[model samples]
Target: AQSVTQLDSQVPVFEEAPVELRCNYSSSVSVYLFWYVQYPNQGLQLLLKYLSGSTLVKGINGFEAEFNKSQTSFHLRKPSVHISDTAEYFCAVHYSGTYKYIFGTGTRLKVLA
Candidate 1:
């Protein structure tokens, strides 16, 4: 079974600061990487994905991630983050054939005013 690991459980940053949320995965076969965000009590929203072709994938809310196959990592980053960006970020990987999703523990981003 595939799995994802979010290196940071929580991240605290001031408004307008840069942030990076680390994500790593382990899989035996080809996989699809995804980044999703969840606001308080809200459903998860797709942020970005890496199905194929590009290594660097751009996502919503000024977020982006680079899929490094060699490292099995897809770290999310934002050049400048706002208070509204505060949310729980999850890294998920889907098995190409099974279509089953394996999600990371989650990284909580707390933006301070």
Candidate 2:
């Protein structure tokens, strides 16, 4: 079984400030990590993914994360956050052959202007 954990339930930041959203996962088999963002009343949008390759991965809107094998973590970060970045972010783990993605509870990012 695969599972994901989002350490923070909510994070508040001022506009143009930097932010980080922590995520961790556990799986018996190899897995793919993904970060998705859900805007208010909107569907989830894929922000980034870690399938294979370099440990450090970059995503849209200046977001980036590093895959730590030893720690089993993939934490998302942005150099500068905007009000538009305010949303519910979810971390997901897709275990190979399972065809299922286990999602975290989600972290709500509130950007104050």
Candidate 3:
């Protein structure tokens, strides 16, 4: 079984500030990690993914994450964010060779202008 836990449900920040959204997961077998961003009334866009090799993964919109096996964590980070960054972010895991995915409820990022 695979499960994901997002540490925060909402993160509010002023424009041009850095932010980190924490995520943790547990799985019996190996899995793929993914971060998706969803704007209001829009579908999810792939932010980044950690599959197989490499511990650090970078994604669109100046986002990045480091996969830590020991801690079972994959936290998203941005050096500086803009008001446009406000959206819902989700952490998800997919079992190897399986279509089923486990997703964290979501963490809403509100970047105030």
Candidate 4:
């Protein structure tokens, strides 16, 4: 069984500063991972994904993630962040040769001035 772990439950950063949200998953037969962001009172929106090819994947809102096969990690990064960027981030993984999905708890990003 594989599980996803978001290292930080809450991250507080100053506006315009760079940030990196860490995510790690246990190794499995095949790796299908995704990153999603949720604004207040809104559902999750796809941020980026890693199905195959290219370890580095870019997504909307200037967000990107790099899949490290050796580390079993898909850490999200942003050169700079805005106050509007404050939201809950999540990661989903499909592993263990099953159709079932493993959803991450969430990593709350609090962008301060």
Best by TM-score: 4
TM-score, per-candidate, Cα-based: 0.95, 0.95, 0.94, 0.96
Task: List the lowest-lDDT window of 10 residues for candidate 4.
Answer: 96-105
Each model's lDDT: 0.92, 0.92, 0.92, 0.93
**RMSD of candidate 3 to true structure, Å:** 1.2
Q: Write the per-residue lDDT of candidate 2 for residues 76-107, one digit (tens) a residue.
A: 99989998999999999998888888999999
Candidate 4 overall Cα lDDT vs. reference? 0.93
RMSD of 1: 1.0
Whole-model alpha-carbon lDDT for candidate 1: 0.92
Off by over 4 Å in 4: none
lDDT of 4 at 98: 86
Model 3 C-alpha lDDT per residue in residues 1-113, reported as the tens digit of each score: 57799989999998999999999998446778999999999998999999978899999989999999888899999999998999999999887777888899999999998
Q: RMSD of each candidate?
A: 1.0, 1.0, 1.2, 1.0
lDDT of 1 by residue, 1-113 (tens): 47789989999999998999999998557889999999999999999999999899999989999999889899999999999999999999987777579999999999999
Candidate 4 is scored at a TM of 0.96
User: What is the alpha-carbon lDDT for the whole of candidate 3?
Assistant: 0.92
Where is model 2 poorest over a 10-residue stretch in terms of lDDT?
Answer: 24-33
| Candidate 3 vs 4: which has more TM-score | 4
